[model samples]
Target: MPDYQIRTLDDADIAAADALFLGTLHLPPTAAEQLDNLRPSYVPGRALGAFDGDELVGTAMSYPSALAVPGGAVPRMGAVSRIGVRADHTRRGILTALQRRQLSSLVEQGDVIATLRASEATIYGRFGYGVAERVRSITVNPSTAEIRPDLPRVGRTRLIDAAEAETLLPALYEQIGLRRPGMMTRPAGLWGIWRVRETKLDGLARTAVHTNADGVADGFVTYRAVKSGGFRAELRVEDLHGATPTAIRELWRFLIGLDLTAVIKAGSQPLDDPLEWSLVDRRAVGVDGVTDSTWLRLLDVSAALAARSYGDAEPVVIELVDDLLPANTGRYRVGADGARRTEATADLVMGVAALGALYLGDVAPSTLAENGLITWSGEPGQAALGRADRLFRTPTPPYCGTFF
Candidate 1:
């Protein structure tokens, strides 16, 4: 066995981490820029490389993200992605040391949770992470699809040039990410997503804007058109947000009713999204299936609690202990604002990674307690813990738009 040491990556490691990431997947180091776009929260120091003497053999990267839940907003969820160990380093406890080191660092900083887009579903479970939501999809006929069967709504659909996307799209994603779950921040290069796929970026792709009483751009959808016997579309909703129903409906209708051939494909939707219901014919909607995109692992419980906004309610204290990710061992008193008010007088501790999943969405505390991942001090305390979680519940299960 070669000598090994785990250390926080610095500027020098960017080259090595990029090399390992690219080589394992057989891409050039240029992918570092692309993957960097996916990781808006990456700090070189926060990303780690497991080294064997002079060679970079493995890596584990995490970043800041958010989860959309019912009633209110939560902030700063840590999403773990791009975790890999070169084949040569496998089964040697390299992964174990890397995670242990990362968890220890996160615990010291006081962050409660973390998430990931798992490459192998089976691998992360042993670390105490679990799937919290399923990202579902829909395929539609574009020829038959139209924003409105007849004319336009209060909003308008325009074939804006790609250059305009830099200004228009990011504003729209802000609203969507704030109100929705399992959504992560978009990278700077996202503005180029259209052109890489098409030359004009407007042939099949376009933006539909919904404006409110004040005439502010509220929500938008981006899609590609395919004309067959009828038109077929694979629509990806970049972001949809607004203050009123008309604004939201207008954007939804614009995409679904676009002038096309027959079908449309849309994915990464929230479970309770109203788009399907807005259609007069419910049968027109079809669900491909629900699947998980974001898998969570808790880094630190206290910082995780205090990072985002929560709903209004009385405060509750709960103790937490961890197994698989041992660094996150502590008791926490969570507040109505979703803030951490105090360290628990004692540690309602569960596995660190399981807490990360629960933070990503709603994984009931009692079920885990029953499963023996946690020990509830009392039924009332357990009930309080469950109800306390109401703040992080999502209108839809968390869904990531792209694979990490």
Candidate 2:
């Protein structure tokens, strides 16, 4: 028999669950007012708790959102967050149990995928999650940076107050839409949590919006300034989204022109951001580091495979091994036409985690095979690996800039 029981949490159980989660992070309990502000963001029937008799020992929850896959298909995805287990319960199966239960629940609700920003690198792979996207942390010397003379300056940017941000930002974000693979639609529940964190908890963030020549809002950025010393400060960009290249350039131009800021730092920026090319002096931007951002798990393998468009390549049969979701363990034929289950022999074999990494086209099949994450069904050759690589290749590197 198991030592703990897992069940969905109710309104009355939220406080205990929150406290248990906080304890695992070595953080203090949430204050009454902050908790009150955060309570409604929890979607009913989504949060789960593992109970050791009457004690809440583990907690996990997800927000309902849609992920933009390649070829402009938006599929339902569960944005998982706040997963934790009590420190005393280490080495036990409580964390595994919670993950299994949560994944099963998400599958039953018809979610095609699940994703999370991992707090640690080693925790989630066994649960079938894979690092799907990567981001770079960049620091710019604003004083030395200059926008190139040839870059278009078609848009105008203006700062907005917090109250205006609360109303205008969401609408502008929706208008911008998900133009890139791995981006996600922010639902009301997720937005509520961000609002609480920005306004109630931190209260230091600011916003700026960009408008096209016709005076339509097309992009926005949120950031906070921190004093570095001696009257100089560093501006940290929290979030930035743009609908067009011109809008993105204009927004950066506005930020570079801000007063009293010595440097600007932005995290989780896409690998293909044109900021460097737009600058007259490319070395003005310094790359601090690159890190994993979004980790993805394919809940429905067939549906996910068919949703994204593929590059031109001959068909290749891939045999998937899904231990947690046994129904997905089978051979699939993937090509430019689409993907479907096949009875023919597979050319290559991989596990679900490998599939997740390959799904977004961030990592090529050849790279995964070289890393020992994939194997050949027969004798290994470059033909199959090259075909798979071309089939899954994307024009731009996949990036998920949102931090849940």
Best by lDDT: 2
The CA lDDT of each predicted structure is 0.60, 0.88
Report the number of the highest-TM-score candidate.
2
Q: What is the TM-score of each candidate against the true structure?
A: 0.73, 0.96
Off by over 4 Å in 2: 199-203, 377-381
Please report the TM-score between candidate 2 and the true structure: 0.96
What's the lDDT for candidate 1?
Answer: 0.60
lDDT by residue (37-141, candidate 1, tens digit) is: 434334655688888887889988765445443344454455565577898778998888887777666555444566677667888777767776666677644
- Model 1 bad stretches (over 4 Å): 8-16, 23-42, 64-74, 106-112, 142-152, 175-177, 180-214, 225-245, 306-319, 324-327, 333-349, 367-404
- In model 2, which residue pairs have backbone atoms overlapping below 3 Å? none
